[model samples]
Target: MQFRNELDFAQDLDQNDPLRVYREQFHFPKVGGKQVIYFTGNSLGLQPKISKDYVDEIMKDWRELAVEGHFYAEKPWWDYHERLAAPLAKVVGAKTSEVSVMNTLTVNLHLLMVSFYRPDNKRFKILCEEKAFPSDQYMLKSQLRHHGLDPEHALIEVRKREGEHFWRTQDVIDKILEAGDELALVLIGGVNYYNGQVFDMEAITKAGKSVGAAVGWDLAHAVGNISLSLHDWGADFAAWCSYKYMNSGPGNASGIFVHEDHLGKKDIQRFEGWWGTEKASRFMMKPEFEPISNADAWQISNPPVLALAPYLASLKLFEEVGMPALIEKRKKIVAYLEFILGEVAETVSGSFEVITPEERGCQLSVLLHGQGRPLFDYLMKNGVIVDWREPNVIRLAPAPFYCSYEDMYQFGQILKEGILKLSTVDSLG
Candidate 1:
C-alpha cells in the first residue's frame, strides 16, 4: 500500500474502517475537554464503556442473591469462570478446555514452571530473550534460585547482535541448540515489549522441541494484538495479562493456555486448590484432589467474580469481532502508523528512527537519539498519550480496536512539531 501523507487520506481510511465504531465502545481519557490521542494500548488499554455495566451486574447478583448467587444468579458465580473458556480459547487459538482465566501473569508463569521447568544435571538451563519484561526476568531468576541454581549459570538469554534492536529467529534457534544438553525450558515473550517484535513462536517452539526442551511464551503483548494459535503451534504452556490489548482493566485477571497434550498427565505437578477440583467432586468434602483434566487444573483459587467481570465484558467483544477481523484491521493501522512515522522521520532534523520491524503489531518503538523526555513531554502536553522507555525509546501503539488512522496521522503531526520545538530549545540552550 502506498500510504499518502495527507490528512484526508487518514480521514478517508477512518470513514471506511469497518471497526471504526469500536472506538465509541471505549472511554478515552479527556485532557482539557478533549480526548487524548491514545497510543499506549500496548501498556494499558482504554476502559470499555460497558465495563461498568458488567461490574454492576456482578454487584447486583451479590447484593440480592448473596450465597445463592453461586448457583442462582443470571450469570451464576459458580460458573463465571467457565463462561470465559470459549472466548479466551478463541483469542488464544486453543480448544476451550485448554484455556482458563486465572491469576496474574507472573503467578501463572511460576505455576506453569512448576511442571515445565524441571531441571536436571543434564538439562538445567532456561533460554529466554534478553531484557525480557523485568517481571519475567525476575520470575525466571527466582525460579532458577528456587531450584538451587545460579541465574548466571542456569539462565540463557538470546540477545540480538550488537547494534540490532531485535533477535532473529535463526539466532534464537541456534541458541536453543547451543544450550543443547543443558536446556530444560525455553520461554520468550510472544511479542517483545521493548522492540515490539513478534517472534516466530511456531518455529521457536519447534526448535526448542527438537532440543528436548519445553517451550512456553509470555503473551502479555501478543494476546489480542496479533493472531495466535498456541495449541496448533504446540506451545507447552503460555500466560498473558488481559489489561493491555485485551483492554479488560488495569491489573485484571490473567489467562493461561495449557495445551491439551500437557493435560491429563499425572506426572505434571501444580500447586493445588479447590477451584481446580472436578465439579462433581468439589463439594463432596473428600480429601484427595480429583483435578479437572484441562487448564483449570492449575487454578489455585475459585474465580474472582468481580475481577473477571470486566474481562468477561471485553471478551464478549472479542467473540463478536474475532481475532481474524481484529488482525486484519491491525495490519492496516500498523501500515498507516509506519507510513506516518516514516514521513515524520523525513521531515525532522532531529535524530529519530523507528526500531520496530515490519514483523510487529500495533507498537512502533521510536528511538529518540538526541531528543528524549523533552519531546515526549511535549507530545503528552499536546494531548498525545504514548509511553517512554528509559535511555531513549518511546513506544506508540495505536490499538486497532479503538485507535483510528486519524489518530496516527495526528500523532505523527505531534511528533513532527515536538521534534522541531525541542531542536530549537536545545539550540537556544
Candidate 2:
C-alpha cells in the first residue's frame, strides 16, 4: 500500500472509508472557533455526541423512578453493569460470562491481584515491563509491601537492550522463563503506554503458566484499538479502562476478564461485597458471601449507571463498525501518518524518531531529539491536540472511530511547521 504526501490522497481515502460516517458521531474540541485535530485517543478519547443522551436517560430514570430504578429502569440499575458485558466481551475477545464491567482500572487490577498474585516462598517474584504506567508500578509495590515483602527484592522488570525504545518479543519470553519458579505472576500492559508496542500476550501467558504462574494484562490502550483474544490466549485475568480508545468519557467504569478456568474456583480470595453475591440471594441479606458463578464474582460494588451510560454510547459504535473493520481503517490511517512523518524529516533540522512498533495499533510515539515543548506548544496553538510524554516523546493516535485520514495529513503539515519553527528558534538562541 503505497502512500502519497498529498492531502487530496488522504481525502480520497476518507471519501471511500466505510466507517467515515462515525466521525459525525463524536464532538471534537474547538479552538478559535475551529475544530482541533485530536490525536490523543491514547490518552483520552473524544466524547461521542450521543453519550449525553445516554447519560441523560439514566438521570431521568433516577428522577422519575427513584429507588425503583434499581429494578424498573430501562437497564435496571441493580444489574446495569450487565449491559456492557456482551459488547465489551466482543471488544476484548472473551465469553460473555468471562467479562464484567465494574471498578476503575487500578482498583480492578488490585482486586485481580488478590486472586491471581498468590506469591508463595517458592514463587515470590512478580515480573513486569520496565517503566510501566505509574499506577501499575505503585500497585505492585504496595501489594508486595502488604505481604511483608520488599519491592526491590520481589519485583523483576523485563528490560530492552541498550539503545532501544521498544522490547523484542523473544526477550520478554526469555525473562518469563528465566524467572521460572521464582516468578509468581506476570503483569504487563497489553499495549505499552510509552512506546505503543503491543506485547505478545499469548506467548507470554503460555510461558508464565508453563513456569507455574498467573498472568494478567492492563488493556487500557488495547481494548477498542486492537483485536484481542484473552480467552484463547489463556490469560488468567485482565483489566482495562474505557476512557481511552473505548471513548466512555473520563474515568468511566472498567472492564474485567477472568478466564472461564478460574470462574468456578471457590478457594480464590477476593474482597467480597453485596454486588458480588448471587442474584438469587442478593436481597436476602445473608451473612454468608455466596459469590456469583462467573467473572461477576469480582464485582465489589454495583455499577454506576450514570458513568456506565457513555460506555453504552461508545460500544454501540464498536458493534456497528466491528473491530475487524476498525482495525483495517487504523492500519491505513497510521500508514498515512507514518508516511507524512517521513516527509517532515527532509525539512526539519532535528531528528524525530518513532518509538512505536509495527505491532502497534493507532499510536505513534515520536521522540523529538533536541527539540522539546516548543514544538508541542506550536502544535497545540495550531489546534493539533496531541499528548506529550516526559523528557521528549509526543503521542499521536489516529483513532479509528472519529479520527480521519485528513486529520492525519493535516497533523503532518502542522508538525512540519512546528519542527521548522523550533529548529530556527534553537539555532537563533
Candidate 3:
C-alpha cells in the first residue's frame, strides 16, 4: 500500500504475494537471455509451461487413434469440447450448461447477435460504446446491414462527456433511456480496450432491461482481469477471446455464454449446424435440426482440441487460485502501479495524466502532454513491453496471473527514464 519508489514497493509487495509461485509456471519471454518485464498481457498473455504437455496429450491421441480418436482416444474427441465447460464456467461465473467453448471471438459475436439482436422496424437500433474494439464496431454495422437496416441511423454509441476519455455509468444509462423506444439491444465491452475502463455491467444490464432491450458484453479484456457473474448479473449473452489474460496461445479458441432462460426459446433465431444437433441422434445424420438444450446448442462445428488444450491448462490455474483471491491480488498490484505513476507525474509537472482510473482495470492509460511514440519506443527498446495505442495513449496492464510486483516496479523505472530522455530531446529541439 505504501512505497517510497517503484522498486521498494515491488520488493515489499512481491515478498507478501500468495500467488507469487505461479509465475514460474509461465514461459516468460527473454531478450539477450534476460527476462523482459512483460506488462503487455492485455495483448497476449505469457504461455503456460503446462501448455506443451496439454498439446502433447491431444497430439498423442491423434497419432495413436487416428480417425477413431473421436470415440477411442483417452479424453474422447467426440466429447472433447465438453471437457472445457466446467473450468470455463468457473472463469465466467456461469453454470456449466450456460457456457461453451467455440469459434473465434468475432465469429461468436455474430452468432450471438443472430439470436439476441432481433431488430424489428420499431425497436431496431443497437446501442454500444463509442470507439469500441474495431472488430465489434464492424460486426455491429454488418449485422445492421444484414438485417436490411442502415447502420448510421440504426446504431447508437454512448460517448464520454466533452473532452473526457471515458464514459460514466450515468451517461450510459441516460443514453439507453434516450433511445428507449428504438433500442433493441445493448452490446458493450466489459472493459474498454484503449482506456482500460471497466464498465458497470450490472447497472448497464439493468438500464437495457428497463428499455426492453437484450444486453450483452464482449469480455475480451475483463474475463481474466476482473470478477464476473454473467448468470447472476442477468446478462442475456457474452463472448470473449482467451489469448489475452486467459493465457491461451495466440488466436486460441474463444467462448460464449447464453443465459439458461434463453435456452428453449424456439422463437429466437440461430444459425444452426449439426454439432448443435441433439448429441444422441447426431450420429444418425438426421435431417431435422433438434438442438442440444443449452449454450452448447450454439456450437456450429466440432471442437478444436489442439487449440483448446492451452485454455484448459490456464483455467486450471484459475481454479486453484480462485477469482476472489486473484482479484484481491490484482488490486494491490494495480494500486501500486497507480501510486508510482502518480509519483512520476508529480516530478514531470503534470506532463502526464492517467485518463481512466475510476473506471480502469489493472491497466492505466497515460496521456503524454506533447510526446507519444518516442516515449513508447524508448520503453519498448529498454525491455519494457507496454503497448501504445494510436495518437497518444500507452496501456500498461499488470495482469495478476503472471505479472510481478518487481515487473511493475521495473516498468515504472523504465517509464520515468523514457520520459526524462524525451524531455531532454524536446528541450534541444
* Model 2 lDDT tens row, 205-243: 999999999999999999999989999999999999999
* Global Cα lDDT for candidate 2: 0.90
Off by over 4 Å in 1: none
Q: Estimate each model's TM-score.
A: 0.98, 0.98, 0.97
Tens digits of per-residue lDDT for model 1 on 240-336?
9999999999999999999999886666778899888888898897888888888898997989999999999999898889888899999988888
Clashing pairs in 3: none
Off by over 4 Å in 3: 6-8
Ranking by lDDT: 1, 2, 3
- By lDDT, the better pick of 2 and 3 is 2
Which pairs of residues collide in model 1? none
Candidate 3 lDDT score at position 239: 98
**Residue pairs in clash, model 2:** none
- The model with the greatest lDDT is 1
User: lDDT of candidate 3 vs native?
Assistant: 0.88
- Tens-digit lDDT track of model 3 for 4-113: 67466677788889999998999987766788888888989999999999889989988888899889887887778898888888888999999999999999999999
Error of 2 at 392 (Å): 0.4
